[model samples]
Target: MARSEEQFKKIRDQRYEEISNAALKIFARKGFAGTKISDITSSINLSHGLLYHYFKSKEEIYVALITNVLELFSQAVEEAESNNGTPYGKLRWLTELTFKGDFDVALDRHMLLMEAMQADFLSQDTKEQIIDQYTTALKGIGRIIAEGQQTGLFRDGDEMELAAYYISLSQGITLWNAKGLYPIRVSADMVLDPLMKRG
Candidate 1:
């Protein structure tokens, strides 16, 4: 009985992973509005019934993808915070992670999901949840900036404002990179130097 239960759990986990991977590829290639359950099924070689068994609808899968992406980002920030580095180093590391570092390959897909959410396609509750998650993540960055100021590692300024600036800058880079206006090959360190050196 125990063995059977373990096998079932393993199969369930595997199915979920397969579905997520298929969804990532489809959503990245085609925006959320353009992706369909059939697209995911075709990518995964799964039946529509099987896909529906895992996710009630395409929107559910999108929400799950967004949640997973945010969790991965949060984990990166947490790991950077726990590292034994100077405040400036930590900030640099965080900036690099946010901008140039390798994140989940599904990030492009997640960007599409964000656009849909902003268009009011996602429910208000989900929108609020996403905003709260983003706010929490930014607050973590703000705390680091505040620490840097206290330790004389950063210039004197409003930590919240600086945090907001960095957050917006990171998002802008993503958008511009998507539009081919900015190169993804540029290091975040290169971008941060001028901004950090501002008087």
Candidate 2:
């Protein structure tokens, strides 16, 4: 009576995700440099050797968590960009989709992101890769804004600046959401009113 191969694989993947989730919270509070594999291991019931069995090192876990978050962000932006519709529609879609106060932009999910921005200890290569993913997101926002301007749905201006403006707004929502305000769901329209076209 041995476990089937598929059952073993399922159990392995479940433990892998459990480790990743525990690691994310530690990374959020301690920052990557301050967090060790033991810190992650101690927080979960799993033994020390079990964590290492799945991930070779803290760096591997850090990258896995970050890359997963980046993929989610990238997919949302990509969907907005590829939509053959009005720029205003795309802009609205991106804003609503991201700041919905769920996993997509939850402060917990992105706590690593805010900390990483000021993390001077990270390797130059890691920092560049993070910024590169963020920049791709910015470009997607820019396309939506550029379309809005061309269609007279928005005022003409620097698209990147506009892109930054929108992202900053979402960040503000995320920050407030972290404090239990849940502003994104309640005040999204009020928060975004100033930016939308008046006519």
Best by TM-score: 2
lDDT of 1 by residue, 37-144 (tens): 998898778999988888998989988988887787677777777778876677788777676544445357446546645846788998888778777777787788
State candidate 2's TM-score: 0.87
Tell me how candidate 1 scores on lDDT: 0.74
Question: How would you encode candidate 2's per-residue C-alpha lDDT over 1-199 as one tens digit per residue?
Answer: 9999999999999999889888988888788888888888888888888888898888788877887888888999999899877776776777777766464336766788776656687678887898899889888888887887777777668888988887787777677757874533645455455456666
Evaluate residue 93 in candidate 1 and report its C-alpha lDDT on the 0 to 100 scale: 84
Could you tally the backbone clashes for each prediction? Answer: 0, 0
Q: Identify the runs in model 2 with alpha carbons over 4 angstroms from their true place.
A: 101-105, 181-184
In candidate 1, the residue pairs with backbone N, CA or C atoms under 3 Å apart (3 or more residues apart, or in different chains) clash, namely none
Off by over 4 Å in 1: 1-8, 99-110, 175-184, 195-199
Local accuracy by lDDT, each model: 0.74, 0.78
Which candidate ranks first by lDDT, i.e. highest? 2
